[model samples]
Target chain A: MTPDKLKTILLVEDDDKLGRQVRSHLTEAGFEVDWLRHGHDALAADPSQYGLIVLDLMLPGTGGMDVLKHYRGQRCDVPVLVLSAKTDAAIKVRALDLGADDYMTKPFWPGELVARVNARLRRPLANAGDSIEIGRLRLDQSARRLFVGEESVDLTRVEFDLLLALARRPGVAVERGWLAEHVLDPERDGTGRTLDVHVSRLRRKLGDRAVCLQTVWGVGYRLEPDA
Target chain B: MRLRPRLALTALLAGIPLIAGSVWARSAIERSNAVDGLTRLVLQRMLDGGRDECSRWPESWPIPSGPGMGPGMGPGMGPGMGGEGMPTWEERQTRMQAMLRGGGGPRAFSHLGPPVEFFAYSADLTSRNRLAPALHEDLRTGLLDGRKVVSRGRSNDSDSPLEIAVRMDWFDEPESPSAIVLARQVGASEFGLAREFLWGVTALVSVMLLTLLLSAGPVVGRARRLTRNVRRSATDQYATSIPVEGSDEISELALAFNAAGAQCRAHTDLLEQRERSLREFVEGTTHDVMLPLTVLQGHLTSLAKTSSGEQAATLRDAIEEAHYMTSLIQNLATTAKLEAEDAPPRRDPVDLVALCERVVARHMPVGREKGVRVEPVLPGDPVVVRGDETLLEQAVSNLVHNAVRYVDRDGRVLVVLSAESGRFSLRVLDDGPGISPDQIGHLTERRWRADDVRARHPSGSGLGLAIAKEVALRHTMELTLGTAPELGGLEADLQGALG
Candidate 1:
């Protein structure tokens, strides 16, 4: 995708009121949004020009599912966030199975919609090669090491993966369920308590710099760049 | 009293009287034939002139009364006859032997069988021989009536005797009637053929009854099978029907049962179709309501963001009210989904930490606006349990929303998550005034709220905690409420197994 595409979003919604609100919210969140009311218009648009596409499942003239299928058929890898008024799990699962990245139900907060859009737009940090630097801590991806100031801190395999998972999306809170699946060692139990143990130990090792690794309450951990 | 035993009992009850009647008839005919043979023998002997020779041969012989003698004449005219000048036993024996040898024409009693014994008596019973048994009352009455009297002597032993007695007229002198008595010992072999015939009849009757009972087995079994099939079909909502086995009444009953089962199945199908349509309508209405609710929320949010001071606060309350309506609609929908008998709650792994975090985040703005400090003290890692993600999220959200709504301004609402052993627990505690002990039990009751709560938050749906309780029960978790020991407020705690 082009660098400008990261600032652009494609929104396809049929409900006039909800569609206007979503477009305005995205715009107010500093995104360039292309709003379309019909699924056919979404199908005609080049998906590659947009970094994130917010598609509503209910649309006139060829429904949203057809447009989603068409884009996925063309191998358009842009993130698609499905918006629906249906609360049925089967429909949500079907949308996710059809290559939708996220699903948001109706009556959603405008601020929440903006947050989800930005989260999707943030590129996965695995693509960042070699090293990643946030605050005084630097994560060497290849070497599998974390350095706090001049001292190189030692972390276990699970601790490094946990820290790396949070560090990937600096300010965004990662879900503990996702972290438990992706960060914990496959051979271990990977229970919540076990994950908690690793985090506490990692915090102890981080010492004064542990402030950067903030807990997002009921969510998972987040890493903030210290000024 | 099943079919087999009932048939056998009826056969037995009917067979007993028939067997008895047949036995009595056979014995009567046999006795009559024996009496006839004896009568012919005695008459033939008299025709041979043995009675005339024996009558004058000796006075020991019982004879018809002479013309001058009557029934009142003094006894001593024959042996064993009581009189004033009765003869000695030896003398009588000599006279009896002389009379039998002297009898002319044909030897007396030469035609008689050795098994038989005979005696003669005068019409008044005053001239009977010593060997004759005392006359029975029934036999005596029969002889007086001029009918032959035949009887089996009363003896329990096998060698019991049978006697036949009949009145006879001599030389046409009916007034001087004399009777002859004959007796013979009886053995079982005497009626061996009759016994065999009777045994055959009894065997045949028994076989007939047994055959009837045995044939009823399949019918009884079929009836039992129909009963079992009816019960089984009921459990499966009448998906199966009974097999009609015969053209009899049982088969007719089976046909009737099958018809009834078909009707039940049709009714069940109709009910299921109605339920599915109702679910679809509810989901459709929720979706329709959600669209407008979202727009109103968006408008209220923008209005709140643009306004300042008291106006902004009022808009914020409006936004909060809008959010409450959205949640209320969602909760009702979830309750309806849970109540549907066919749809069981999904068992997917849900992270309680993430659930609590999102809930706290959603209510944090309201908490901030209310000056309530909504804090979350979660375990450093995730606390995942097996449940439906949406339901658990909603349950936790309700708990936090209730806490934020009820807690006084500047009060603290603590949402804590912890994992111990293999189980995960969540506690939402607020430092507001705790409920009375009486109200704790009714906290989860649908549409129930305290009087004070109704006055304070009139827009509250009173369904949040109820929904949470239902979600907890469906997931096999325990949701308990009590006073928070440290926080001095209402505490809601939910605990369940790890996913």
Candidate 2:
């Protein structure tokens, strides 16, 4: 964590009330939120400087879609969450297809928006380095591999994705739904029972180290490395 | 076409030919048969009478005979002759015709009742009485061949043509020139055809009527059933699908109806489920939101009650209301997030020591203002867990706030965090009025079914504990409410595996 390059976000929204509320909420959540009202300003500004972007689709001067298109066309990979009042399912899918990392319908809970932002931000933070370690557990991102102390362990693709999702935010309770989306297919959440099965199998594979996986009943699962 | 009418039409069409055939046969038989019979009788009588008369005549008397006629070679011929003399063939022919013309008995040729006429053909085949013989050539040939011939022709003797025919039979010999012809005028020529047409039409009508009668029952019954079912469905009437009957047009309709009913039922079920869940969410959200709104209203009412003298305190309360508002909104968002099956909550490393410290820090100002000491008893080492960091903070702060609000003005509230036995625990203890015996048992019931708590504590919405329980559940931690043996007050504990 550096002073100049803090975990900051550029938020572009037209609504003053929502803007102030979200800006304050994100600030309280320990992010330096640079609030902007116009899409022109957002587009003119360097998109790569921010760690994340919270964009409202309805914007003045330049439309939000245009800004998104131009920014993504320029290959800016900073995660963007398109926040809008357009609750149509197709619109959300289109935004996602157009490279927006996530879509949140309007009237969203501030904490939920922050949670989604934080989830998206975790990727870069975890992917920034090639490897991560939590006590005896270590992950090698480049090799897509995991190590239990000095003993290298065998893992399936799903196991690796699951361990990676948990290891990236060690000590954090990842929701079962989110874990399923990242570790398995996102569509498999329709029947949540499969997640429980996968988690149990993952814990079995960990054996004596299964303590790292903790069940958060009715919510999801969490990873604790130093258990 | 509908099956009812189509079936009726089919029967009618089938009956037409049958009626026509029967009527034609009866008419032809009645007309031509009588005429043929009379003709044969007359010819036979002429031949036999000529033979008898000739045989009984004296030997000196000359015999006028024709080929194939036996003149007096038979013994029984004596009484049959009009006189014992040979008569001319013409006279004999006249006598035979007179004999046959008399009555309908065996010896009479006119025995064919009414509507019949007699004709005599001499040996040379000349017709008598200006009667035009029907099938003249066939009769002549048949007479020569020793066979009876019958045929039909239309007669114009009356204004309307009568179906008239003749029957002729040769007598005595195959080549005999003597023959008798008979004609009978049946009713109107078209009477039979017209009768046949009438019968066919009648049969067709009856067949159609019968078809309708038969089909009406099932078709109309099924139609009514379908209407009833559709009406019921329209009025939100629910039942199993209408029972399908035999394989017909009606059965297909029923199957289609059943499919529609199933879809409607499924849609209704889905709508009901969605409505129920929405209502639950709204009620829960309202109650939770009301906590802050009530607090704000209380502050407003207090500010309104007091003069400008307590302006500073009122302003502080206002600020407190705003903070509560933000947190209430956050709780709402968290609840909404929990509803989505695909969204994994943001899991970050939660520093329990710092969390407890922060909870103490937030509640300390209010506690100190009330003269209560809010202190953190966190371990020296970093106590961390895996969970949604913001939620954990909110949960711990909620517990601390509960302690601050409930404890006496000068009481002590301890925010405790410790790691032991491969786990970490965060507990908030207060030397305030402890939970009642009844309330303590149900402190962490998963659902918001805490009516007793709301009943006991009217001012508190019990939202704080519910939130703490939710957060603890999210983190897979245990949130327990117990009497602190050391502090002798309510102790709220959240414990989980150490991260």
The number of the candidate with the highest DockQ is 1
In angstroms and one decimal each, the interface RMSD of every candidate reads 5.5, 13.9
lDDT of 2 by residue, B1-499 (tens): 7656676677777777766676666666644554456455445544556334323432211132333233323222234444544456666555444433433234343334333333444445654333345435655565556545544453322223232222333344443323344344343434545566667667676866786767687777788887887776667645566777888887888888888888888888898789668746744664445333423433443343354547756655564455455445544544444443224445566567645644554455446545687755544346777766656766787788778777886898877665666787777888998898679777667453333232434246367778788777767788999997657789998889977
Candidate 1 per-residue C-alpha lDDT over B1-499 given as tens digits, one digit per residue, 9 for 90 to 100: 7777887889999998887777667756655555555566555544444355335432344332233122322223343333344455565565444433422112333222223444555566534345555766766777667665455552223245556665555523533323443333334333554577689779888888878877888878888998998899889988998888869899999899999999999999999899779777876788789889888877877777789999987987787677787777777677667757335578765677656755765676567666787766655566778877777777888888888778888988888776767987788888888888878877755442223222434465357887788788888898888998758898999988998
lDDT of 1 at B298: 79
* Native-to-model Cα distance after best TM-score fit, residue B320 in candidate 2, in Å: 17
RMSD (CA, Å), each prediction: 8.6, 18.3
What is the C-alpha lDDT profile of model 1 across A2-112, one tens digit per residue? 558788999999889898998998899899999999988888899988889999998878888888999999999899988887767667667767898776777777876
Clashing pairs for model 1 are A218-B353, A218-B357
Candidate 2 on A46-103: residue-level lDDT in tens?
8888888898887877988888998999999878888755423345556766888766
> After aligning candidate 1 to the native by TM-score, how far in Å is the CA of A120 from where it should be?
3.8
Give the residue spans of candidate 2 off by over 4 A: A1-6, A133-165, A169-221, A224-227, B1-499
